[model samples]
Target: MMKRIPIALYFLLAGLCAAAQPKKLDIVFIGNSITQGGGLQHPLEEAPPVKAWEWLKRAMPGSNIQYSNQGVSGSTTVDFLPATNKLFNNVVKAADAFKADKDATLVFSMVLGTNDSAIEGPNGSPVSPEQYRLNVKAILDQLLSSYPGCIIILHHPTWYSPNTHNGARYLAEGLARLQSYFPVLDAIVAGYRSTHPGQVYTGYTGGFSYFKKHPELFIQENGRSGVFQLHPNAKGAAELGVFWAQAIKKVVGRLK
Candidate 1:
């Protein structure tokens, strides 16, 4: 009985050690119509939010994850600030709720700037690259201040319709313009990663490049559309989702 006492204490210590481990996270996603699933419906519905939630659920089963889609159709980076503003309150509410929740670990994934680039400014002038960069930086700055230590993944806007006006040529040009703004984005990510080392910074524009390389990954089956459209079909979204999921998994895997 005396000899067993130390062994029992050791076992008790191990049990407590196991109990002290932190719980897995519940992630949140924020973005635009792309995140909300604007088009492409054949069987599962044409909603990006619904499809994204479904994908996350299926991809990370039993991981105790909760995905909240706060994507409004036609929202710009400039629209995220001003909490009292009717147009942006929904996003503010979601961010506030995440902040208030102690148990939840926030993961913010946003896809903006597309609308800002597409729409003319109040002066009826097309938003310049410099202006777009400033708008993106502003939104990221606010997010960092509000949600310190939270993981953030910023996605570049995907391709637009190739036939609509400038078409694919215009989208390709837009990508070049967008890449120039990546340094600003990098600064933001670096600032956050300095504190929250476990956080992720990823882009789906690379995935678009991948599609260009391997067109077979996105075959036009059952009358489904291909890339360079105004919006992504299920196939396009799935491809992008796979890239995002992989990036996220890599980030989460390194968390302590």
Candidate 2:
């Protein structure tokens, strides 16, 4: 026979539960050319990356959040793993400078696979769907293994290239296939998180939906007639940033 807990004590315990939750996110943006924020003219030159940072900063201004961009121009899913490995090694060397301080939660925003769809290999070999999926999984696994309890947000690659003929369709199809594989990644991460409990894995596919709704925003200059460029323009980047921010915010809320 247990004694009944007082209502005031229950309220005090609830407050303590909320207080014990984690705070302070340290997010790393890792990806290809789009993440590098390329091709926007002066004044708008930093628009792409800046837009993303601004959104995050606004959301958690006082959360001790730190955002780092590890994007590289012309990178694909296959190229990114090596790049991150090098960065993580450097971070390990400069542990004080690179490692997240206490109270910091790690998060990774990844957008890749577009270049793999566009470019052919040395022997003109296109990256097969299976290879693309494997590359994505390797990247996620590496990050999760390195940073225990890290939160990963896997984004679908955005569209570029006009008329759907010049490689856009190929990339779009690759993204679709990538989306199908995300549940597998989620399941893997979910199992890992159950043991590691603090880890989080979330995904969202907003690329196709946004492009289908806002075609005009991504139009590229073509002397007289505008066309779609392989990379997003200023307006397009802002739109992409908004989609990213909203999706990330939702994930953050759920995790919290």
Candidate 3:
């Protein structure tokens, strides 16, 4: 015959155990076709390689977190700006409507700057670096305000084909975008979190380096339907997911 524990003791023990769990977090991934899982029809459950959420789930099995993919095919940064019908506004407004817990941590994983770098003009300007910086800052400022203390992770999309298969399109566009736009974007993130670092980061997905190394290969290709060099195949996507996961893991480590 064992002695029964007091009811108060049981409640207190349960509360302590629950409190021991890591803080819950909500993560949002926003971007273009790659983030939309390569603009193809894959099984719904087969997670995209660019999504760090699934990676996080595997890495931190015990962690409490919610993740969503708000990516669209062929979307530019403008679509993400806090406008009436855009994704940024929609995400924030819906979160507010749902009354997301004030105590829960929020994370934003943003991948952009691909279509923006398309050389639409003779001068090779799709969206100028300055404008890109402005667009990125506007979104960041809005997010920081809407979800105070949220950590922002900005990703540079993977490599583009080197040849002029599209005519001066992004002839070495991956390198051009990195050299031209990455600095401004980094500066903006740094500016926002000057007082409090670790609130923002830039994740380079190695598209430039990978393409530069394989000078002979013009594209990252998959024989699978609708897969192309500009868009990564499942394997390429998974590789990107690794890069993104590295960036997010740093933030996850800090969360209590």
Best by lDDT: 3
The per-model lDDT (C-alpha) reads: 0.56, 0.60, 0.64
Could you tell me how far off, in angstroms, the CA of residue 154 lies in candidate 2 after the best superposition? Answer: 0.6
Better of 1 and 2 by lDDT: 2
Candidate 2, overall lDDT? 0.60
lDDT value, candidate 3, whole model: 0.64
Model 1 pairs in collision: 36-48, 37-48, 162-167, 162-168
Off-target runs (Cα >4 Å) in candidate 2 are: 1-22, 42-47, 83-98, 119-125, 162-200, 219-226
Candidate 3 Cα misplacement greater than 4 A, ranges: 1-22, 46-51, 93-99, 121-125, 164-169, 173-175, 204-207, 211-228
Worst 10 residues of 1 by lDDT: 162-171
TM-score of every prediction relative to native: 0.68, 0.71, 0.74
Cα miss at 69, model 3 (Å)? Answer: 0.6
What would the per-residue lDDT of candidate 2 be over residues 38-113, giving only the tens digit for each residue?
6666323454555766776776555555666666666666565535564444323332343547667667777765
Assess candidate 2 and give its TM-score to the true structure: 0.71
Candidate number achieving the greatest TM-score relative to the actual structure: 3
Q: Write the per-residue lDDT of candidate 3 for residues 1-256, one digit (tens) a residue.
A: 9999899999998776555544676777777767777534471433353356677677656667676766676666777777535667656754564246776667778888776776652222477788888888888878777766788888766666544323325545644764577678778766866665768876654655775454343334543223235665555566566677777776556655
Per-candidate Cα RMSD to the true structure, in Å, reads 7.4, 6.7, 7.7
